[model samples]
Target: MHSDPSGSTDRIEKDIVINATRERVWSTLVTFFWVDEGNLGTIDPKAGDRFVAHSAKEGSFPITIEKADHPSLLSYRWASAQEGAEPGEGNSTLVEFTLTERQDGSTLLHVVESGFASLPSAMAERAVSDNTYGWEEQLDALKKSVEG
Candidate 1:
C-alpha cells in the first residue's frame, strides 16, 4: 500500500497475506522466529535487550527491541556496527509489522520500514539492498511456516 513516490529507501514496504490467522502471523512476526529461530541476529528477545550482529561486513551492530504488541505488531530500533557510529547512528528505520484478518480467514501482513536515511552512506545502501531480498525470502518462509 506504499506509493514509493520518491523511490528511495525511505518508502520501503513489504506486504503479504499469510494463510494463518492474524494472531498467528502476528506471533511469527513478533516472537517465535526472532527469539527461537534467530531471524534478525543472535539476541535474547527482550525489551531493552541489546546485542551485536555482523552485518553488511560492518562488524557487529546494535539491536534493541523497543516495543512489542503481541498478536499484532513488533517494533524496534536496529543499530549499525560500523565505527564512528552516532548514538542513534547506524540506527534508523522504525520497522513495523501489522497483521489483519481477511474475509476468508487469511491474514494480511504489512511491513513498513521508514527512516533509512539515518544509516551511514555505505551501510544504508547495503541495508536496503539486503533487506529487499531478505524480506521477500522471509515471506516465503513465513508462508511455509504457517501453512505447514
Candidate 2:
C-alpha cells in the first residue's frame, strides 16, 4: 500500500512501477491511453510542451497540458465534467504524471490531480473520491497497456 494524503485532497496522487522503460511508458501516456488534443496535443521526450486530453463525453471539458520533463514527468490542468462549457465557459483543473526508474530497470509512474479545490464543495469531494478510485483503475490500465 502507498501513503494517502492525510487531509482535504483538493488534489490526489498515485504511483506504480511497470515492467518497462521510461521511453516505453512515455509512448503509452502520449500516443495511447490518454486522449490527444489541446494540451495533450504535442509531446516529446523533453520539457516545455503541453499535453491536453480530449473528451468523448458530451460537454466534458478538455484537460489542458501544462509541463513535461521528458520520460520523467508530465503535468496538466484537468477540466470539470460538470461545468459544461456552454458557449464560452471553460473549466480547468490540475493533473500531472511522473515517471521514476527502478533499480531493476523497470518504470515507476506517479499521477497527481489538482485544482479541484475550485469546484463546488460537493463536486470537489466527489471528483477527488472518484478520481482516487479512477486512477487506481487507470493505473492498472496503464500497467497492462505498457507491460502487455
lDDT on C-alpha atoms for all candidate structures: 0.62, 0.65
Where does candidate 2 stray beyond 4 Å?
A: 1-7, 32-59, 83-91
* Backbone clash total, candidate 2: 5
What are the per-residue Cα lDDT tens digits for candidate 1 across 11-124? 369989888888767655554353234445322355666544443434444556666666676666664324324236445556677777899999988877666666555666
Q: Please state every model's RMSD to the true fold in angstroms.
A: 5.4, 6.1
lDDT of 2: 0.65
Task: Return the top candidate by TM-score.
Answer: 2
- Estimate the TM-score of every prediction: 0.70, 0.73
Model 1 misplacement above 4 A: 1-7, 32-62, 80-87
lDDT accuracy of residue 20 in candidate 2:
95
